[model samples]
Target: MADKKPDSPSHEPPRGPILVPVDFSAHSEAALLLASDFADGLGCKLAVLHVVHDPQNMPGYYARMAGKKTLTRMADIAGEMLDEFMAKVQKRHPERHALHKAEVLLVKGIPVTRILQVVEKEKASMVVMGSKGATGLRHLLLGSVAEQVLGLAKLPVTIVKEQPKY
Candidate 1:
């Protein structure tokens, strides 16, 4: 009779898509580059997510008059902004196509909550985001969206620390 041997761990590599949340900031650009590197190394896809929070919920007089006209104007502005951002990124990183195709998604809601929603919808294996570092009393008082998302999301999160000098 032959003795049974323990099974060895499979050598299969981790495979899945990577999602990057962008706010069209320099920090976001850094995070996108990081995500691109990871995606290229892992042979995964990269998706860019931008959340356009509903202005109605924002604390201000704008919330009081969130009528059709106001909403339309806001949507138009958001669309233009997103378009410009995508164009700039595309222009800046022409070599990005070699790594992986990009996706631009525009959603509305609380930034962190919307991000989590997209993560679930996309079935992303991991998320990359930029941390706009807040210091001292500001950090303590307002808190950070990156930190909030880091604590809340179920999947792994890669936080790209912004340059402290900037």
Candidate 2:
């Protein structure tokens, strides 16, 4: 009888970019770094997203009081900050060739909702974000965006937490 070859498993390439949401925090920076490495390894693009939470969406009197002009200005400032953040990332990871194809995205909306929207719109293969690891009242009030994303995202989600200081 002729020798038979064993069946080999297929290795499928990643379908879309890796999404990293940043809030200009150190934890977010760590997430960006980790996502960059993953993107390089997977030969996929990296998308750095920053969401400007709309003040108009705030509950109670504040939402009603916020004017359109003020909301516009806030969005503009957020865009500027996002640009600065991207610049810093570029400076820090100048040697990361994969980042050459990275896209910086700034959008206005609730953070978690906008993030999920972008993930679907961008067809992201995975989401990597930082968790502040908030606890107690702060966590209850603000809610954890990473946790929400992890629960809701259809694709893989990676939450990078800051290492504890000695």
Per model, how many backbone clashes are there? 0, 0
The candidate maximizing TM-score is 2
Winning model by lDDT: 2
Which stretches in model 1 have alpha-carbon errors above 4 Å? Answer: 1-14, 56-72, 98-100, 163-166
Error of 1 at 128 (Å): 0.5
Candidate 2 structure quality by residue, lDDT tens digits, 31-148: 9888999998888999999887855645332222235445546667667667777788779889887666789898878889999999999999999999988899978887799999
lDDT of 1 by residue, 21-125 (tens): 887788887888888888877777888888777656444423333454565555455666667777887788887762237777888778899999998898888
**lDDT of model 1 at residue 11?**
53
Whole-model lDDT values for every prediction? 0.76, 0.83
lDDT of 2 at 1: 94
lDDT of 2: 0.83
Candidate 2 weakest lDDT stretch, 10 residues: 59-68
